[model samples]
Target: MNASDQNALVIEGGNQLKGEITPQGAKNEALQILCAVLLTEEKVTIHNIPDIRDVNQLISLLEDLGVEIHKIGDNSYAFQAKEIDITYLQSEEYKAKASSLRGSIMTLGPLLARYKYAKIPKPGGDKIGRRRLDTHFLGFEKLGAKFNYNSDHKYFEIDAHDLRGTYILLDEPSVTGTANVIMAAVLAKGTTTLYNAACEPYIQQLCRMLTSMGAKITGAGSNLLKIEGVEQLSGTTHTMLPDMIEIGSFIGLAAMTQSEITIKNARIDELGLIPDIFKRLGIQMEFRNDDIFIPEQEHYEIDRFIDGSILTVADGPWPLFTPDLLSIVLVVATQARGTVLIHQKMFESRLFFVDKLIDMGAQIILCDPHRANVIGLDRQIPLRGIKMTSPDIRAGVALLIAALSAKGTSTIYNAEQIDRGYQYIDKRLQALGANISRI
Candidate 1:
């Protein structure tokens, strides 16, 4: 973290928080949708946008590109890409700003599709694992773009005089890769067939938003997408979905602290398999209309498989449980009655935070980089608070959950990591009766 973002949270543990809280706009969706503004010169208004660090940084990058920006209302902004400042994009200032966050990499798609040229520094994000860009350039190459990696300066460059779309199969179902290719394909010369694409809800929202902006796209919610290139796109209004990962985090928080918490307007329909996966972990929740009410429970037991085997909580592609919430699931299982094997397939380093949890008295066996065997304490022994450092956004919040449920007091360094994805989390949790304060 930079000097501006350096901070800490001192939480008084063993507090049973109560009351209702609403989640912010989906962070992942907002990142992609904001970059989509580059596809048109007309005014684009996005509503319910989260005021998180990553999203805000991307918005600033848009302004640096000469996009007209105005905050029309609370959590809403209007963007107009009337003229892009190509001069500044090649400057040192732009390089520093764009290299700070990973979302800046998505800008290449719109720039290449519209201006026939694009370049970006190698993006930086969580130090979880290797996130590749081959899927992006390979798809762009299939669309008649010339590609080259300037490894000397750690950046990528691509150009095309005329983008002619063609059939391309992604080696992996990458969300951002699918998004980059989608924006590039929407303005190409011919129809592009993308198979084995990621079908995350956020990706669906991107396609739907582009369709609203005069792009012809089919099969949004499935892995197969066909996009017929249009001459240009116009502006449109878009509203983002609630952050399902936050909703899951809140559910874990309620269970861990034994609190009665109501999460309002969660857009429960779009949270495919999240609640069910938490249900298997013995978290009791009631769906009331659009809200989820998790009541306080003295005890909840993990459910075994039908064949009488221990439950294995794992993450897979979309329509399955999302990988983002696996850390939250790992933390919640620490207090449950039964054992579970957490199989995190997406990243290798997310489970490294288990050492922090172990310091607080949770019995976890780090089987390998990709899996962990968690022996739930069943509240037989209350977790004791200790000092630890926040690793990344997801793991940071997982540690916060641990601190909130632990006994006595805990001090967590690098609270800024938590702030990257969540908006004013400390203040929101305070309203819910959590004894947390930033320093």
Candidate 2:
């Protein structure tokens, strides 16, 4: 879905949303898992898959490569790719559309590792900043992969027949860059050591999936990853990690509306530093085993630093607050008690959406393209919800968070942006007792 599928979301503000909402599987993790099917010749079962646009597009690409896919159950898929004919993917239309998604570019590493050749067009995604594919190419080249490029096209020629693993230190800890390298190194001839790797939950899930397929990997969930190549890969089953971004979004939604809600099966362990990040904003939460419950509260105050300095919430590699959820945090910060700095070092233009929040009557200082200083309104005057539109995936959810907290009805156009990352957002928020509807 694109702009044509745009819907008017009428959010009746000022009501406490109350109920339990469970997060779907991770979108980034599911994308990497889907690409793993190209590695082996056996049947593979992937569980807890998120039904989103990127995943659907990759599945379509897999089918076009002669992979037999069956939906076994809800959020579950059975994949059998005994043979892949890369010749079928040589068409410009297919390559262009396939590479339009960031996740689609990950297919290149796996395809080249297994087939020794892959034709991938320039990748496309949200126009938030300069997202480079050089990191991916650099990592692949370290593993003996050669590349050919033209003004309109790029193809990798990897001789996996003599592929040798080597040490690769990425220029940046790019998520897709790390994923591409991990997939390629899994079947290389020797051991590979990756430092400065993206150790997010999605990367950990990818490592776990590869381990289950008989590849030797260690130091998952950390910045360093060790991979020992195997002669062949046997297909196996692996489930996706819970989406922490979705969990944080719901937490913000509940806070904005003064709602009491529970996020069930939230996989708190995987969200190592996230809870404390929100805690800095003084948003209260109670953990009932695996569920995170937000109690009904009148107001949440932002906690200042020990030196009486303004609060600073920044994103880093894994075990830090994810950059993907920084926008939601910025929105939440706008409603808190004191001032806070929302720093998004990864994406330059992610903080530009603060203008929309300001339009809704929030006090925020746009520090730059990558940072914003949000002064909490403390509910002095409830946000006057107004007409708005979603800009990107994370910003879209942030806009929804702001709208739900506003005083009047709000319409968010291009809601498909939100749908790309979060699954069944409307139905799930409704179950949490939000007065939100789509027109």
> Per-residue error at 362 for model 2, in Å?
0.6
lDDT of each: 0.93, 0.84
**Model 1 C-alpha lDDT versus the unseen true structure:** 0.93
lDDT of 2 by residue, 1-439 (tens): 4553566577887777888888899887888889988989899999889988777878888888889999999999999889898887778767767767777887877887788777777766776898888888888888888766666455433444456789989998888889889988888999999999998888888888888888899988777889888888998988888888888888888888888889999999888788888888889999999999999878999998899988889988777778888998899888788999988988898888788889999999997888899989998888888888788899998999888889988888878778788887888788767788987
In angstroms, the error of model 2 at 324 is 0.8
Give candidate 1's error at residue 162 in angstroms.
2.0
Q: Give the residue spans of candidate 1 off by over 4 A.
A: 1-6
TM-score of 1: 0.98
Q: How much lDDT does candidate 2 score?
A: 0.84
TM-score of 2: 0.96
Q: Give the per-residue lDDT digits (tens) of candidate 1, residues 1-439.
A: 5663459899999999999999999999998999999999999999999999999999999999999999999999999999998777688888898988899989989999888888789998887888888999999998999998888998788887789889999988999999999999999998999999999999999999999999999999999999999999999999999999999999999999999999999999999999999999999999999999999998989999999999999998898788889999999999999999999998888899999999999999999999999999999998999988888999999999999999999988988788899999999999999999998
Clashes in model 1: which pairs? none
Runs in model 2 with CA error above 4 Å? 1-5, 153-161
